[model samples]
Target: MYLFRLAMASLANRRFTALLTVFAIALSVCLLLAVERVRTEARASFASTISGTDLIVGARSGSINLLLYSVFRIGNATNNIRWDSFEHFAHSPRVKWAIPMSLGDSHRGYRVMGTSAAYFEHYHYGRGQALQLAQGRAFASDPFEVVLGAEVADALKYRLGEQIVLAHGVATVSLVKHDDKPFTVVGILQRTGTPVDRTLHISLGGMQALHIDWKAGMPAQGAGRISAEQTRSMDLTPQAITAFMLGLNSKIATFTVQREINEFRGEPLLAILPGVALQELWSLMGTAEKALFVVSLFVVITGLIGMLTAILTSLNERRREMAILRSVGARPWHIASLLVLEAFALAFSGVLLGTLLLYAGIAGAQGYVQANYGLYLPLALPSRYEWTLLGAILAAALLMGCVPAWRAYRQSLADGLSIRL
Candidate 1:
């Protein structure tokens, strides 16, 4: 009890240094926890973005690339799969439903996805949840009609029956605009916290109509422009699509369908399990994740080192105080234990402060994170792995405490009594 009081008095006397040390440790702990949380949640969000689909089929390309463009609205596809090829697999006995997707167009800045009404019926995200309309309904058979994602509607302040023009290419701003064939917003989707929320949905026919006046990817100077009324009577069938997503009738058939698509003679095609492709994509980012983890660990070690420095630096000024204690019957081991206790107290306090800061920050930014990044960070207790990390931190603090404790133990009676300052 006496040693504890003396240690508390010593820390209070140098409260400024003690406070700074605690703050350093707290910030380090916050960063370590934040990095791990974001890493875990980001990967989970990536995986859950498009679920319930057995495989994603695209032109022969890297699995990660296909997953990126098809699901995440990332880079352009190297080549498009034929519409007929999509039909062939979509009708197979082994397949349940295949959702065709055509890309390479944009409205304002959001991506315009050419798909079918079947998309609303068949496409699922975040565990078999079907797409639902928050207002209005899905697009009809008309090629001039379009549906808006929840974010598209909210961000652009669009309403049902509003007319919007699409750009020729996928750029945020395009020189060539399809102004003649404006689409009526027929539907607004409910928020899914996925890529679906960021996409503008249109029929495959609409996609073909947008490019019908073009030949070899450039608009013909004198090409005939078709009116919206004329587009209905014209052949609106699509020639090729960027990709397609398939849901299989049986999980056992996944490998068989994958093999069939890889060896497809109709066109150079590729198919991959969505889960496997997601893993492949994440593997590309594994280095960044590891780097963050290593940096966080270093920050923690640095914080502990700061605490050790503060305690060791204070020991010299306290040599006379220590000699007085020795004269009053205090042992060197008691002095050593006092330093250890002070170190543990600082560490424990820092840990608590850091944990509270982490949770508070997470709670405050949860909505913004989901709105911008489509990542849902759960406000749950520390995970088992986190507990292990905390335990390791505690153990490291104790080990560091031994440093100043040993220094104090080595001090002699004469050394403390002869201190000048």
Candidate 2:
């Protein structure tokens, strides 16, 4: 305890250099921990993007491509499945529930998804959590009503009862729009930290009504144009959809259902287990994730090296101090122990400050990140693995401290009662 106080007092004497070292280490530690937390949470979010669904059925394509378009909304689908085919499997005894998805539209930059009320009740994410409305109610039988995702509403500053127009295509700056049939935002979903947060949802009837007046991929002109009110009286059932998700009555029947959907006579359909597909997609991204972690680790090592350099550099100037202590009944080992304690104190303080900085950053940016990137960064306590990482950092610091400690001890012994300078 005496040695610790002595070490701290010595550090206090060189507070400027000590503070810089601590700040450097704190920044590095904060960066490393931030990267790790994002990596873990991103993986969790990716895996939980779509849960409680047994099979995702879509037009035959690469599993990754299908998963990308269906769940992540990354790309366009090669083909659309007939709505009758969706009905065929939806009514099957093995299927518990099904949610049809009709994509390929966009509001501003956010993708527009056409689905049923069953979507709110059946679709789930993040540990089987159902979609909850943060404001207003879900779209009803009205073909002009739309539901906005958390990110979509927040980013676009939309409110319930406000009318918004959707583009005919999924482009950020779409030239063709369904301006004639403006939809009213009836609901806003809570943030889900998934692709869903970036989507604008509408009923299938609304989706069909938007295109009801179109002829051969082009909007009707003048006399042929159909207004939104006029389309309400027409049958607006969707003819096709990009994909659909299914929940099975029994987990054991998953493979059987997948096989049946893959071999369905109505169309060239593909069915995949959401969990397996998510894992496969995440595996492709593992290399990049590891690379980021390695980069953060190297940054921490650089910070530690800077600390080591600072300590070693100060040793020459403090040689006279060491010699005086040696002459005043301080053993060489006490000098070494003092250096060790100094290093430990610096590292411990850095770790603590870094943790605090991390939490502060999360608290400040949590809502913005979730609103913009659909990633929720929680300000929760560090995990066991994080504790292990901090421990490893301290251990590395201790190991590095030994080098300067040994050097100081040797110098103190050689310059007993004499100043080198």
Candidate 3:
């Protein structure tokens, strides 16, 4: 305890340099921890993007491609499955529930998804959590009503009862739009930290109504244009849809139902287990994630190296101090122990400051990140792994402190009572 107080007093005498070293280490530690937290949370978020569904059925395509378009909403589908084929499997005894998805429309930059009321009751994410409305109610029999995702509503400043037009394609700016058949926003879903938060949802009937007047890829001619009200009286059953998700009555029957959907004679359909597909997708991104972690680790090492340099550089100027202590009954080991204590002090202070900085950053940016990127960064306590990381950092600092400690011990022994300067 006496040695520790002596070491702290010595550091206080050089407080400017000591503070800089602590700040450097704190920044590096903060960065490393931040990267690790984001990597872990992102993986968890990715895996939980869609859950409680046994299989996802779509037109035959690469599993990654299908998963991308269906769950992540990343790209367009190669082909859409016939709605009748969806009905064929949806009615099977093995199937418990199905949610059809009709994509390929956009509101502003957000992709528009056409689904059924069943979607609200069936679709789930993040540990089987169902979608909740932040405002108003789901689109009920009205074919001209739409639902906005939390992100879409917040970014575009939309409210319930507001009229909005959907474009023909997924482009940010489309020359062709369903302006003549604008729909009223009936609801806005709560944020899910998934692709769903970036989507604009509408019933399948509303989807069909938006494109009902189109001929080929272009809008119908002036006389052929179908009014929104006129289409309300017409059959709005979707002809085809991008993809659909299914839940099985029995987990044991999952493979059986998947096989049946893939082998359906009605169309070339593909069915994949959501869990398996999510794993495959995460594997593809693992390399980049590891690279980021490595970069942050290197930054921490750089900061520690700076600390080692500072200590070694100060040893020359403090040689007289060491010699004086040696003459005044202090053992060489005491001098070495003092140096070790100083290093530990700097590292421990950095760890504390880094933790504070991390929490502060998370508290400040939590809402903005969730609103814009659909990633929820929680301000929870550090996990066991994070504690292990911090322990390793302090251990590494102790190991590094040994180098300067040895140098100071040799110098104090050699220059017993002599002042070089």
Candidate 4:
């Protein structure tokens, strides 16, 4: 207890240096914890985005691209599966449910997806929770009715019963608009923290209605434009669909169904397991993740280096004090313990401050992230991995203090009964 008091007094003598050391470690700890949290949550968000769907089927292409466009909404699809393919699969005995999608349109920079009602029925996220309507009701069998994702509604400030115009061919600035026919927002989905939240959804008939007056990417000038009622009179059969989400009738037959979809002779198609494809995507992103982790480690090393320099540089002024303590019957071990104890206190204080900062960050900015990017940044309890990382940091802090402790031990032994200036 006396040695501990002596350590406290020694730290108090140089409070400015102690404070600087604490601040340095605190900043490093903040960066380290923040980066790890992002890594864990980002991967969780990615994996949970398309859960409960057994497989994603699309036109022949790499599994990565298909998953990217269909699930992540990161890129465009290479090609589209024929509408007949969707029909066949929907009726296939091996399939339980299938939802078709049509893309290549956007509303103010957000992707516009044309899909059937099966999307809301079969699509699930975050541990198989079905999509729920936050407000209003689903489309009541109307051709011009639409549903908005939580992000789209929030960003565009749209409400139920508001009218919206669809743009042509995914161009935000396109002059071509479906001005003749508008969609009424029938429903708004709750936040899912997935790509679903970033999309504007409508029925395939709505997509067909918009393109009725245009052909081969050109407007039919003489045709003028038709109203939504006229669109109902015309056949709304879709030739191609961007992709389809599939659910299997039997979980055990997933491989068989995937093989059948891949080998379907009607047209070249691809089937990908959502889990397997997500792992593949993570594998592709592992390099970036590793780089982030390495950068955090360097930041920690830099902080430790700053602390080591401050302690060693101040040793000259501390030598006289060390000699005085030795003259008062203080053993070398007591002097060494004082140094170690001071280092531990600095490190402990820094870790505490860093953890508080992290909590404050999550509390403040989590809502913005969830609303805008479909990522839920929850303030979770410390995970086992986090505890382990903290333990490692504590150990590193102790080891770092050993340098100054050793120096103090040597100084006390050499200056017995003599004051060193």
Ranking by TM-score: 2, 3, 4, 1
RMSD, every candidate, angstroms: 2.8, 2.1, 2.1, 2.5
lDDT (tens digit, per residue) of candidate 3 on 1-421: 9999999999999999999999999999999999998988888889889989999999998899999989988899999999889899899988999999999999887899999999999999988999999999999998988888888888899999999988989888888888889989999999888999899899999999988888887899889999988999999999999999999899999998888888888889999998999899899999998998999989888888888999999998888889888888898899999999999999999989999999999999987887666688898999999999999999999989999999988874567456656
lDDT tens digits by residue: candidate 2, 237-261: 8999999999999999999999999
Give the lDDT of residue 236 in candidate 2. Answer: 95
Task: Sort the candidates on lDDT, descending order.
Answer: 2, 3, 1, 4
Model 2 alpha-carbon drift over 4 Å, by segment:
412-421
- TM-score comparison, 1 vs 3, better candidate: 3
Q: Compute the lDDT of residue 129 as modeled in candidate 2.
A: 94
lDDT of 2: 0.91
Error of 2 at 387 (Å): 1.5
Q: What is the per-residue lDDT of model 4 for residues 129-195, given as tens digits with 9 covering 90 to 100?
A: 8999999987756778889989899888999999998788666587777777889999999988888
| C-alpha TM-scores of all predictions | 0.89, 0.93, 0.93, 0.91
Kindly state the number of residue pairs that clash in model 3. Answer: 0
Candidate 2 positional error at 135, Å = 3.4
- lDDT per model, in order? 0.88, 0.91, 0.91, 0.84
Q: Worst 10-residue stretch by lDDT in candidate 3?
A: 412-421
Clashing residue pairs found in predicted model 2: none
Which structure is stronger by lDDT: 1 or 4?
1
